[model samples]
Target: MELRYSPFDFTVHEDPYPFYARLREEAPVYHNEKDGFWALSRHADVLAAFRDDRRFSSRNGIRIEEPFWGPQAEQFFSFVAMDPPKHTRMRGLVNKAFTPRRIAALEPRLLEIARAHLEPLLEGEEFDLIDFAAKYPTDVISELVGVPESDREQVREISFAVMHAPEEGDGQMHEGSTDAMGALIGYYAQLTAERARRPQDDLLSGLLQVSENEDRLTPEEVIGVLVLLIGAGSETTMLLLGNAWHAAWKHPAERERAFAGRIEDWIEETLRYDPVSQSSPRTTTEDVELHGVTIPAGEKVLLLSGAANRDPRAFPDPDRFDLDRDTGGHLAFGNGRHHCLGAPLARLEARLALTELAATVADYEIDEAAAKRVHTSINRGFVSLPTRVTARR
Candidate 1:
C-alpha cells in the first residue's frame, strides 16, 4: 500500500495500528512529502534513533511541525526539545526532585487523589472512566508541582487548550491558540515566583532551592520545565489510564489475569498494545542512512511509538493484547537520555488506577459506540468512554 502519514489525520486515530503495521513492513523509513517529515516505524529503527541522540537531535522541537509561528523548542518545551549538555544541565537540576524516592513518597497522596476521583463512581453502575482518568492525574501533578488546588482548574483548562491546538485541513497547528500558550506560561511565572519566595514543600520549591552556587537553570527554564511537567504528566497519564481501562474492557482474559495476580503485566501489555503517546518527533542533525534510505539532515523524523510497540519483528503476535508476553522492550516511554522522567509516576498512577478499577468492578461493559477518541495525531486515547460496571459483592 502507498504510504502517507499526517499528524492531523483523525481517521487513522480509531485503528492506526493496522496502518502502522503496514508502515513497518512496507516502508520502515516512510517519508511524507506534503508535510515534509520522515517516519521511522519499525521497532529496531525507532530504538536506534532514540539511542543515537547525536544523529537524531531533539533541539529543534519534539513536534513534527512547530506548534506555533514563533520560537518554540527553547522557550516552550524546556529541556525536552534541547540536546545535551544544556539538556543534561537542566535535567540534573530538576532530576533530584523527580527521583523514585520522591515519587514513592507521593503514593499516599496519589492514592488519596485517585480515590477522591473514583469514590463517586463506585456507587454508580453506568459511568465513564474518562472523568476519573482526567481528574486524578491533573490534581496529583498540580499538587506535586505546587499549583494550588484553587488554580488547578485554570492550569488544566489551559493545558487542554494547548494540547488541542486547532488543526487545519492539513492537520497543522492553527494560529489562534498562541494566547493559550501565553496564559499558561504567565500562570507558571506567578506560581514559580511564589514557590521561590515561600519555599513550599513541593517540587517547584525544590527546584528553586537548588544551590545557585553551581550550574543551575534560569527562572524561565524552571517555569518551562514545570509547565511541561504539568501538561505532560497530566494528559499523557490520563491517556495511559483510559487506554488501560479500554484494554481491560475489550479483553476479558487480560482483565481476569490482572485481577488474578498480574496487574503490572496488564499495564505493560496495555502500554505496548495500545499506548497513549503514539509518537516522538526528532530532527536529524546530519544525513543518516537507515533501512536502505538516507534521510537528509535537518528534516523532522517521527518515531512511531504506537507503531513500533506493535512491530511483529520485536513483538510476537503484535496485534493480540496478551499479558503473557514480555513487554520490557516496549518504547511506550522512549529510550535513552530523553526517556520520560515522569514514567515512574505515570506507572504508579496506572497501577493504582487499574488495581482500584479491577477490585471495584466484578465486570464492566464498554459502550463502544459512545466512546469518543481524542482528535489528535500525537496521542491515542479517549476523550470519553461510557462504561457500565457490575460492582463486586
Candidate 2:
C-alpha cells in the first residue's frame, strides 16, 4: 500500500500509526511532492541518517517549511538545527546543566509538583489531563532551571506559543497571538544578565560562567539553548504523558497492568506506538542513497522516527503496543549523535507522571471526542484532554 501522509491530516491527528506502518513497509524512503522532502521510515535507514551527519546536515533547518519563520523562528542557532563544530560547542555548554546528577537531583521536586497538580483533579469528577498532567513538565523545568516564579507563567505561555506555532508561525508573531513571547525573552534576558552579575548555583549561572577555553556560546547561542531547553525540555515529555494516558485509557487491561508495577513497559510501548516527534528534518550535505532513492546534496530529508519505531522488519507485530517485546532498539529518541540530549529527563518525567496517574484515580477515561490534538510539522501532542477521574479516596 502506498501511504499518503500530510502534516495536516485530520486522520493522522486521530491515529498516525497506520500511515507510518505503510511507509515503513512499502516506502522506506518515500518522497512527498507537496512538501518536497524524502521521508526515511525503516528503523535501520532512519538511524543511519540521524547518525551520518557528514552526509546529512542540520543547517537548512529541522522542520518541513517552505517559508519558515523568516528570522523570528530562531532555530538556526538552536542545537537542534545546527551542524558540527557549532553544534558540538553549543551542545557542550548546555550539557553541563542537564547532567545526570542535576536531573536526578530534580526528582524530589518533580514529584512534589506532580503530587500538587494531581491533588485538585482527584477531588473533581472530570478535568483536562493535558492541562493538569501534560502541562506540568515545563513548569517544573522552569523552576529547576532557575526561571523565577514571577516569570514562570509567561515562561509556559511563550514556550507553548513558540513551540506550537500554528502552520503560519508562532501565534504571537501571527499579527496577534499574544505579548507573552516578548515578555519571555525579556525575562530570559534578565535571567541571563542576573547570572552574569551574580553567578548562582544553577544552569543559567553555569552558562554565564562557561570557560572561554571550553568554547563559549554567544549570548544569542545562550538564548537559543534556553529556548530549546525550556521548550524541547518539556513539550515532548508532556506529549508522552498525554499520549500514554490516551493509550492506557483505550486499553483498560493494559492500563490495569501498568498501574500494578508494569508501568515502565507500558510507557515504552506508548513511546514506540505514538511518539511525540513523528519526524525530524535534515538537509543532505552530499549525494546519498537511501533505500535505492538518490537524494542529492541540499535536498531535505525527513527521518520518520515514529515510523521506524513501528517498522515490522525491526519489530514483530509492529503496530501492537506490546511491552513484552524488546523496545530497546526503537528509534523513538532518534539514533546517533543528534539523539535527544534531554531524553533521560523526558523519561524520568514520563515515568513519574504515568505512574502517578495510574496509581491515583480509581477509574479514568479519556473524553476522546472532546480531546484536541495539537499539530506541528515536528511535534504531536494534545491541545487539551478532558478526562473523568474517579478518586481512590
Candidate 3:
C-alpha cells in the first residue's frame, strides 16, 4: 500500500498514529500532493520546526482549509497565525489581561462547575461523558469571557459548527461553518461593544482595558481574541476531557491508578499518548532541505505533534499508557513562542474535572461501540462518549 497522509481524510481521523509511525520511519519528510502539504513526523524534527518560527512561519494560519488558510487567518486565529512584531504586539496586550492570577482565581469556580456537571450525571445509570466534558469547559470559558449563561449553549452550538467538517468532502469549510463563523464573530463583536460601554470584571473587559504604554487591543482585535478563545480555549479542552476518559477506559490498570489519585500523571500521559490536537499547520518562509528532500519555500507544512509525542527516540515505550512515565517536554501544548497560551487553563480544567470525577465515581465503562468521534480537520477525540459509572457511596 502506498503511504499517504491527509488531515482531511476520515480514515486518518479514525486513527492516525499508524500512518504517523510509517511516515516517521519511511518518509520523515512526507508529502501529500493531494493535500498540498509536507509533514514532519519525528519528534526532533517537529520540535525543531516548532522552535524555528522564522523558518516555519505561522503567517498562513495553522489550518490548511480554505477561508481559514490565508492572510485573513488572523481574523479567526488571532495572534496565533501571525509572525512577530504583530504577534508580539497583540500577545503582549493579551498577556496583560489573560494573566496567571486570573486563571488561578478561577480554580474554585472550575471545581464548582465540574462538580455541578459531574454530580448529577453520576446519579444516572448511563450517561455520555461528553455531555459533562463539553458543558464544563464551555461554562468555564463563558464565565471567564463574561458570556451570559443564556447565550452559552448557542455559543457552544456555533463553535461545534465552526469546528465540524463534513464526513465526506474535499476538506473545506462548509457554508454552515462559514455562516456560523459569521454569527460567532457578530456575537462577539456585540459583546465587545457592550463591554466597551459597560466594563465588567471578565476577561473581555480586561482585554478591552489592558494596555501597554497606551497601546490597547482594538475592538476588532478583542472580538478576534474572544472568537479565538472559543476554539482554542473551549473546544480543545472539551475534546481533551473526552480523550482522557477514553484513554483511561482503554487501559484498565492505568485507569485504576488514575482512579487511585494519579490525576496529574494521568492527565500528562493522556496528553502525550493520545493528544486531542494531532497536528498543527505552518508555512515555510524559505526552501528547506531535510532527509534528502527539498521542500520549496512558501509551502504548507504540518508539524505532526501526535506522531512526535509517540516517537520512541523521545519516549521509551511510547505506545503504552503508563501513568508512571515522565511526560515532560511533550509537544501536546506545543513549544516555542507560539505555544498554546491557554495550556495552563486547559490543564487546570482537566485536573479539576477529572479529580472531581474520581472523587464521585468509583468506576466507569465507556460504550466503545456507541462512542462517536468528532469529524474535524485538526482535532481528534470523541464527541459522544456513552458511559456508565459506578458511583461512590
Mark the regions of model 1 whose C-alpha exceeds 4 Å error after superposition: 65-71, 174-177
- Which runs in model 2 stand beyond 4 Å of their true positions? 1-3, 66-77, 168-182, 212-214
Residue-level lDDT of model 3, residues 1-393, one tens digit each, is: 999888888888889999988999999999888778899999999999999999999997877778789898999899999999999999989999999999999999888888888878888889999888888887898989999889988988887787664544476777888889899999898888998999999999999999888788999999989888888888889899999999998999999999898999999999999998888899998999999999999999999999999999999999999999989968998999899999999999999998888888888888999989987767889889999888889
> What is the Å distance of residue 182 in model 2 from its true position?
4.4
Q: Where's the lowest-lDDT run of ten residues in candidate 3?
A: 163-172
Error (Å) of candidate 3 at residue 245 is 0.4
Global lDDT of each candidate? 0.83, 0.75, 0.89
Best by TM-score: 3
lDDT of 2 by residue, 252-302 (tens): 887778888887898888888878888888878788886678888878788
- Residue 178 Cα positional deviation in candidate 1, in Å, after optimal superposition: 3.4
Best by lDDT: 3
What's the residue-level lDDT of 112 in candidate 1?
A: 86
Residue-level lDDT for 248 in candidate 1: 82
Select the stronger candidate by lDDT from 2 and 3.
3
Candidate 2 lands at a TM-score of 0.92
Q: In model 3, how large is the Cα lDDT of residue 54?
A: 93
**Alpha-carbon RMSD, each predicted model:** 1.8, 2.6, 1.2
> What CA RMSD would candidate 2 show?
2.6
